[model samples]
Target: MKQNRNFIVGITAILIIMMLASGCVNKPSEQTEPTQITVSAASTLTESFEEIVEQFKIENPEIDVQLNLASSGALRMQIEAGAPIDVFASASQQHMNLLDEKEMIVKDSRTDFAQNSMVLIVPITSELEITSVDSLLNDSVKRFVISDPEISPAGTYSKQSLVESGLWNELEGKAVLAETVKQVLVYVERGEVDAGFVFMTDAKIAKKDTIKIISTIPTSTDISYPITVLESSEHKKESQMFVDFVTGQKGRSILESHGFTA
Candidate 1:
């Protein structure tokens, strides 16, 4: 009878142990989707923003960033047309302001983070002695390029500066209007044009042996870059964090490295 009691006790203990072990077992955790946000930035910001996005992802492993680079005005239109962009980094305050006026951007989120200087660039192989803005007026500069003022902030800045200098009337005839600042750089880098007006940041990325910076063009506008969270964004929380990441010290450091002033 004692042996039977011992066996029954052993079986009860074993059952209890199995039940406890089963209760303690963990189920596999469900993987979560990363928060995805799209950033629409000015063409001149391409290199700097790309680097920043890489670092931002390292620090924010949960958020994914997508970049769409173009002229500030063109980006503004995209936002106006209901594109699914979460953030905007514009080279022109005018474009940002238009968005704000239309309630397209988060009102309190608009802030300027960096400034850029417009520059005159020419092909490095060019034998022409293009020394100054006045050089563009020479008979030798047949085909110069500027981004289209309607779509690009760089073009507007360049045109405004030339108009203020009373050189627009003559240069307009020679100007080949491109869609973006990067296109202006390409025109000069490929020797497609005699010269081009582009941001100093864009000039920095051009091939070292292909393009040369002649001079910095002073603009009537402040030339500061403004960034904002879009009002239409579905992920405002994540979007705001992205704006913070860009306007933070880390982003400034990256921008400075790319010839932009923070």
Candidate 2:
């Protein structure tokens, strides 16, 4: 009986040890779950931002970063409509201002993070001798692709450039507006349109052999990228960290590599 009791006790102890080992393996070393943040960034930052996010993830495995890329105006409206986003990175200060005016963002967290200039692009295969925005109005040019001014900051800037340069009224009929700058690039790359206006960064990616950079809009009409944390964010701390990361060395390098002025 004594021997049996000892064997039973040993078995029980072994089972208990195994259970503890399993618990240790299955349980998280930390008591709390890592924080996660959702970021709504401008479509212009897609490639560069993805690269930066990947680097950030390696360093901050504890924090999860969710990203949504779209037109700044659309993203702003989404936040206003109560989208569960933690951070907002806009292509223009105007959109960010609208969010600030409506109290949708944490005002103190807003900052201008990067800069970009507009460029006139044409398909590489096009024999059209287009050198500037003025050439876009030529009779032979059937269509001029640009982002939608109402939704896309690049479009708005491009329109503003045209209007400021006295081209909007003359070429109004020729204008082909796209929902996003990337879409405009697509139209130009596929030779769907004769020409288009996009950020220098986007032109760098979607337009290499398929498209050619004709000219850059004046620096006076440059757009500044602004970022802010949303007031409704449940992960404000992590969100701010993401914002900081984007504005910091890692983000700046990525932006620069993609042809953005940081």
Candidate 3:
């Protein structure tokens, strides 16, 4: 009976040890879940960031990235409203300045990553000889589309370019405002508008043979891009890493591939 008891106790202890080992192996841990960072970027960054995120994941297996694409102005409003955004990328200094002034972005974290030129695009089928900005004033040109200046940097830049060129007042009446630059591209690509203004990067990704670039609009201010970590971010380390990745050589190569100047 003593020998049997010893064997039974031995087996019990072995089983208990195995169970503990299994628990340790299969137990969930904080490290099991990848860290997630949310990036609120301008609509023009859609393709480039999407590509960068894919490569970013390969290099950063421990981190997951989420993208929120929209006008810089609209994104700033979301951050102002306490949205859990980890990073902010704007197409203009105006929006970033607003957030920086309000103490909403990380100090000294703002970095200019890319520059873009505004281009005028039209449906591929339209044979209109649009050689200049002044051509839009032709009576035959019925309507043009631009983003809402109140919310989109593209729209603001478009308006600025037109105003500086002495055309905003003449074009405003015929202008159909879009909610985003992508929307403006869509409208022109689908022939819903006579002409549309979008970043040169946008024109590169348009539906094949759907749109044609007319001219690059001249703005009084250089169209610069800036990115920064938001003050409300819970993942400051990850956000800073992302900003570094985007401004680094790898990121510049990707941006350049999308027609943006580094």
Candidate 4:
């Protein structure tokens, strides 16, 4: 009888141990840490790139994308200074070319993913009779704003358009230089400046009731946006994947929806 009791107790202990072992084996795995990739992109791409990152995360839940948005020239300088950037997307080919010349970009990684146009914008409530780029020369116009050509692609394009129109010298003295495109938009939106030159995409994102597009400037150079994975990237494969995603159909669709020419 004692033997039977002992056997039964032994069986119960074995069952409990097996149950504990099974629980441990069936426990959910520790959540995986997502691999992070830093992407330094032009400020003009803020909205579109944000959407693309969201969509990319749905498919690549294991990868984390961090965006560093700034003027393309400024971003390029950052990369040149070795800012741990995995990818770079420039609003103009000029900045990308600078990196390429320095061999900072990965071989064959540079791709033109989008295009944009420069536009003059003004506050909707403005009394100015400006309707075209030529109208900016009117005596009623006191001050105009543009991104600083030295550090902003939009500014460079704006200046290029003015120069092409034979108005750079005439308008240069009247121009209020902004550090970034968004600042140019702000100056226009607040009626702080008579008019401001910014990317069409930036204008589209502004409050319609506060700002109005005056005219599309004719640029001398193509306003193409190029993206590339940096040669200094530790996450080259992942960065390339991001570049592919931006240049792919899905990325193009998102960019187009945000008023960028894809």
Candidate 5:
């Protein structure tokens, strides 16, 4: 009887171990659906954001990221039109404010990620001897390229800077308004404009050797880049994760490397 009882006890122990092993084997180790996150950022962020996005993918291989770069206003319009975007990074607070007013952004996810200074750039080897805002009036500086003030945050800031300096009204007709800041860089690179206004960050990535920074605008205007997760995001958790990464050390390093102030 004792031997039989012992045999039954040993058999029960083996069954229990087998059941536990089966449970472990059957349990899901990770989430099955890979989250997809889409981000709409200003064109100015194209280079740096692209680099950091690669790093983000390496860190979270299960998440897929898609980046859409354009003027902040244009992107906002798309988001308003119900385009599927998980995140937004605007060149200025005003654009963020517009989205927040419309409740397009996830509350408490917005952060002022970085700042940029306006810059006056000209073709690197241009013969024009322009030095200051006043010098832009020179006949040699025929075309002044700038982003369209109505749709680009950088353009609006540039316009405000000029108007505040009492130069906008004077330089209006000579100004060539491009659709985006990146377009302004294109005009400057191809010598389409004798001089152009663009963000310092843009001048760094888009036209470092092609153009020379004449001057960095005064910082009194406080141009900041704000990033946020969208309320309509299908992957809110992953969206916030990317936002945290950008505002954190890895993101800051990328921004700083590209001449942006983090």
Candidate 6:
């Protein structure tokens, strides 16, 4: 009888243990979904911004960043049209100003984080003796390219520099308008144009054997890049954190490494 009782007790204990084990196996584990934020930045920021985003991700593993690169003006238009953008980084103050004027950006959130210079680039194989902005007027240079001033801040700066140098009217006939500064670089790289104007950063990224920087527009016509959190951002805190990251020392280091001034 005592043996029977002992056997029953052992069976009961085993059943209890099995029940506890089964409960443990069936219990749900903790799951977390990362928050996503969209950033709209200019094409000029492609390399630098990508590096910055990577660093930001390491520091903020819970935040997922989505980058939308385009001409500053076009990005502003998208933000204005109510596209879901959490932050904006423009290659010029003009586009940021437009957003500020419309109250599309958070007040006091705008900050100029970097600067770039416009440069003239020619195909490496070209034998043109052109040396300065004035040389663009030479008959030998039949085709020159600049981003479209209507949508590209680099194009606007290029036009402003040419106008300041009293060469705008003379070069207008030979000017080829591109949609973005990268497009201008591509045109020059492919030898489609005699020469093209692009940001110094863009020029630096091109293969040395593919293109040559002939001249840089004076610094008086500086191109300032600004960043800001959008008023329409659903993840305002996350957007602000990204803005801080960009204006912080780490981001500056990345920008400077990419030939941008911070």
Q: Which one is best on TM-score?
A: 3
RMSD, one per candidate, in order: 3.8, 3.7, 2.9, 3.3, 5.4, 3.8
- For model 5, residues 1-262, the per-residue Cα lDDT tens digits are 9999999999999988898888844655776776889999999999999998999999999898999999999998999999999999999788889989998899799999998889999988799898987889887777898899888988898888889888889899899999999999999998878999999888887645788889887645698999999999988999999999999999999999998899
Clashing pairs in 1: none
- Candidate 4, residues 25-139, lDDT tens digits: the string is 3666798899999999999999999999999999999889999999999999999998999999999898888889999999698889999998888889999898898888899
Better of 2 and 4 by TM-score: 4
lDDT of 3: 0.92
Per-residue lDDT over 44-71 for candidate 1, one digit per residue giving the tens place of the 0 to 100 score: 8988999999999999999999999988
Q: How do the predictions measure up, each by TM-score?
A: 0.90, 0.88, 0.91, 0.89, 0.86, 0.89
A best-first ranking of the candidates according to their TM-score comes to 3, 1, 6, 4, 2, 5
Q: Rate the local accuracy (lDDT) of all candidates.
A: 0.91, 0.88, 0.92, 0.92, 0.89, 0.92
Kindly list the per-residue Cα lDDT of model 6 for residues 82-108, writing each as its tens digit. 999999999989889888999999978
Flag clash pairs in model 6.
none
Alpha carbon lDDT at 141, candidate 4: 94
Runs in model 1 deviating more than 4 A are 1-25
Report residue 75 deviation for candidate 1 (angstroms).
Answer: 1.0
CA lDDT, candidate 6, residue 9:
100
Writing each residue's lDDT as its tens digit, candidate 2 over 16-134 gives 88988888436556666768888899999899888888988998989988889999999988998998999999998888888888888899899888888889989999998899888
